[model samples]
Target: MTYRLPSLNSLRAFEAAARHLSFKTAASELGVTAGAVSQQVKKLEGSLGVTLFRRLPNGLLLTPQGEAYLPPVTKVFEDLTEATEAIAPAINSRKFRVGMSRTVKQMLPANWPDHDVGLRNHIRDRIET
Candidate 1:
């Protein structure tokens, strides 16, 4: 059977909402309006054809479907983050120095011979030694 994935933004919203059990709090965390969070969650529900939350006067409650779905969703994000972090360059590595040098070259004036030569020599020295 084929399964269609919901929008990433919507899934993010739902994940945050599920974590907090509050759409308003989720919106605050996501830097969007509460209405936006609600809309995204609604869209996600529509896509999944499942009622994930039970809206109440005080706050939201997770449905059985939501309760069951939360762990896997959380795990997927956690796994993705762990995988990305595992493959990422070390913080103390020299990769960032080269990247910064490249950025400086891109932003500096092309006709300034002295500045350009000095910067190039500095970067080459760093790379060589």
Candidate 2:
């Protein structure tokens, strides 16, 4: 069976709001307006067909469903960020040596010198593989 997911942006907004329990706080953290954050959260709630938050006079409160859902969502986002950073070139700047056969090394230019060769090669290798 295939499961459908909602928009990532909506999920992010909901996660932020759930963590803070305030639409205004979530908006501030996300750098968007409170209305936008509320709209995103609303969209997420609608997509999930569950009431995730209870609007209160003071602020917002997480419903039982939201409380139950928050940890997994937070973990998923954290894991995604960690995974992306793990493979990100900007994060992994250490030198990586590739042991190629003589024939493969011969295919590369011997005396070619470029200031951006490492960056270009890294990008090319990422795209190819």
- Pairs that clash in candidate 2: none
Q: Which 10 residues in a row give candidate 1 its minimum summed lDDT?
A: 91-100
* Residue-wise C-alpha lDDT for candidate 2, range 77-123, written one tens digit per residue: 99998998888947665555556666775687764223366756654
Evaluate all candidate structures by whole-model CA lDDT and list the values in order: 0.84, 0.84
Listed in order, each prediction's TM-score against the native is 0.65, 0.67
Q: Any runs in candidate 2 off by more than 4 Å, and if so which?
A: 1-3, 89-129
**What clash count goes with each model?**
0, 0
Q: Name the regions of candidate 1 deviating beyond 4 angstroms.
A: 1-3, 89-129
Which TM-score value belongs to model 1?
0.65
On TM-score, the leading prediction is: 2
